[model samples]
Target: MANRLECVDVGTEYCPCYLAELNECIVCSQLQGKKFCDCNWKGVCVFQEFVWAGYKAKVTRSTVFTRILKKEEINEEVVILTLKVPNKLARDLNEPGAYVFVRGYFSPSFFDTPMSVMWADEIEGIIKIAIQVTGPKTKFIASAKEGEEVYLRGPYWNGMFGQRYIKGMHNSKALVVLRGIAQAPGVIVILKLIQNKNKVIVLLDKGKVQTNFIKDYIKNSDVTLVEADLLSEEGQEVLKQFIKDKKISVIYSGGSDEQHINILEYMDKYESEAYLAVSNNNKICCGEGICGSCEIEIDGQKMRTCKVQVDIRKMLERKMSRG
Candidate 1:
């Protein structure tokens, strides 16, 4: 059997989610219709939570209308939106990998687009998101005025995997690779690493986005920044040398699956033992696991990348093999 997967909502208020009711719980084997408890969860018993909830999922996230406080057009393709939200909600979204489902106020529910939290100011009751206007959903969001309201549903934490490494490492050296619009989420990850006293080095590649929009966010921070084309020979050399020499304990790749696989290959080539974290590139039609849009089969087991934490290396390896 594949190793047990970790559910993002397992111990949160959203515990005993729809998966448990369907005997498809990611953490609790008992809830998976098994006879004995083989779960690795250390928090509240999911099976018991399910039984107590009358075999139903707990109350899920609710949609809230937030007013856009400010909007800055970075380019024709990208815009940064600062939104006014509740202080509690902002605080809840202050962690790395935080994201939310956003849509125009007049748009239908299917127009809801998952957006990464670029920055969250709890004291100010505000959050910023970089919206890349790539499709109809984002274009609609981009058209919203500064004073207009938009629908938001989250405090979602599964935007990236290997979060334990991001939260656990302290006073260590780390590397953050960012490219294109993926650079938005990298801001929060870099801030988190810096807050943990980790010395951070950021490799920035303005992939197809054509502009380094994150420079202003990290300029004043105490991080070593290097701008390069990560797909080029010089960039690959820098990445390889950094892994071979810097003794990096954790590495976060904020880009495509191809970028993650390339980094993994360098780590393997240099025999680096750094923990890897990458953006969840799965097609997430719904932030919740019920959509099945983010589902992928790995090692003969189906996983919802939206909420389940799978091995990052295994996931990238699977993609590499498929290509």
Candidate 2:
């Protein structure tokens, strides 16, 4: 029997396309508008999907008792949650920048949601996640009480790259832009980056109260916090000024679509590099590439975020091509 993707669009039982990079059959990817094989044998292709080495070797689906250790309202609109999971699972998630696919009950039915692991403690078997109430599901998660039981699975996506982003901190100057609850992932990313001895500047686009809530995430005294209403003209000016003054090497940003586009545009103009995290795109259902729900348009081609390793190198290539 041949291995195949779990999506319905493909007619064949096995993926006809052979991925030269992984030397594996993959129906989830295509080349030259044909579902056969890649055209180039050398060089990493931006269009190719990336499967985590651990996930490829074996798929682990174990549900452990996830207890809510702490729940606090960061602000009127945002809440932070600390959960205690299995010791082994918590330790496995020590990779600073990875997220997990969480399954929580809202109305007696289990629905899976992806949440970035903001902080984790292997010895204590504890992990923290931030929740912005965008819908009923999020609202339920935010309202979770201490000792609440939850279920979780995964340490998916580019978590392996956390060390690289952390290593990039040697550049001295780093910038992180975060807006509202949508871009909560920036909290953990910024935290790890600052720990590596970089001079960090955080541009927070939120109200004073919400900004304070965001401030709790950045305990580093060396980080400079700039508050601006990201949706206002003044906020745009602040961003431009920050971009102008810094010889920034790495930027990590998350928020609304417009916010990311602006950051991308500025990065292009300044010739700087960045990793823009997107939490709004609903297409990502399974944290694994097995499900095709996470498919979205990237440079006019459909790609899955769960499968794609998003980094500045690939993003810059796409950005430059668009210019």
Candidate 3:
């Protein structure tokens, strides 16, 4: 009954810019529709990077979870929203902090948004997205409320947290820094880390009001909470000192892309691991792995941000090609 879109209808006239690539396909390039080999083109293949749009989910509850006050703007357009996914799909999402590439919903402007599956209560038939308003297409999403219809695709980009902590199992200490509501979706990843008793410190930068909502949740977790006082330099110093005192294990923060640079600065200062959760939707699309749009040079190789989501260690493994 929802406005669902089963993906990979590309190669059709309307979606000429998209392509597909993955390892398990049974068809050949000629049969599948590849005019040239990747080696001949841009050292990337279209066939092996395929991810399809899956289904549609209509808004069931569209209420202001966090009402905005003064400079606490939500998006550049309609960038952020909180919503729930269907139960059938929610069950498969055992990895809470992972990403689910939502494609079925089309705006007059943009067609896809890879939203983080904040947390899924399978029995309750709900999934939360702390959407940070990004572009014009997402602007429409900001305005949408419960009962409105939208499409979604795969629960891709889910394993980022799992892989991080599994590697951290041998870690001497774990430190986490979460920036805003934008990073709320990654809470699923953090929750799992805490449930497993992973020692990770959390630095949360939230508006005065949003911090209250999270007080209860942080108290219950293994995370060492560091709250940001945005109003005064003295308050902000708390964050600096927390970073100074706590020997950082791993760092994660979500905000504007430039903020990533700041988070990186702190990590670099302390000689710690760091990853940025970019929620402004600046450069993540083509979850297909074929589009090459999500490509960024981390260490030395061009890797897809859409397929990988936020994994700090993977970024460090590569040589810094750009900066």
Off by over 4 Å in 3: 1-88, 94-97, 102-109, 158-163, 166-173, 207-221, 229-236, 244-248, 272-282, 298-300, 308-323
* Native-to-model Cα distance after best TM-score fit, residue 313 in candidate 1, in Å: 1.4
Q: How displaced is residue 167 in candidate 1, in Å? A: 0.8
lDDT of 1: 0.90
Q: Give each prediction's root-mean-square deviation over alpha carbons.
A: 1.3, 7.6, 10.2
Off by over 4 Å in 2: 1-57, 105-110, 158-167, 207-211, 270-282, 297-301, 311-323
Q: Best candidate per TM-score, number?
A: 1
User: Which candidate number has the best lDDT?
Assistant: 1
How far is 288's C-alpha from truth in model 2 (Å)? 1.2
lDDT of 2 by residue, 1-323 (tens): 22222221122211122232343323433423446553322334323423322223223444555888898886777777889877767776665456776656443434667787777778998888877677777776776688777777765544322245555557477778777664456666676677677788888876433644557768677789888887788888888777765477666666654565677677668765543443333356665454567555444545444544444334444545676
Model 1: per-residue lDDT, tens digit, 1-323? 67888898888888888888888888999888899999889988888888889889997888999999999998999899999999989998998889999999999898989999999999999999998988899999999999999999998999999999998989999999999999999999999999999989999998888999988887645699999998899998888888885479999999999999988898888899899999999988787788799999888989999998888887887898899
**Per-residue lDDT over 1-323 for candidate 3, one digit per residue giving the tens place of the 0 to 100 score:** 21111122222221212222233121224313546432222322324333233211112212112211112234442133334555655664546445654432444314566676666667866665555554555455555655555665555543243344433443434555555555565566566567666766666666422442344445654567766643458755665565565544444444444455555566568665433333323355655556567665543444455444333534533323335
> Which candidate, 1 or 3, would have the higher lDDT against the true structure?
1
Q: All candidates' TM-scores?
A: 0.97, 0.72, 0.59
Q: Give the TM-score (vs. native) of candidate 2.
A: 0.72
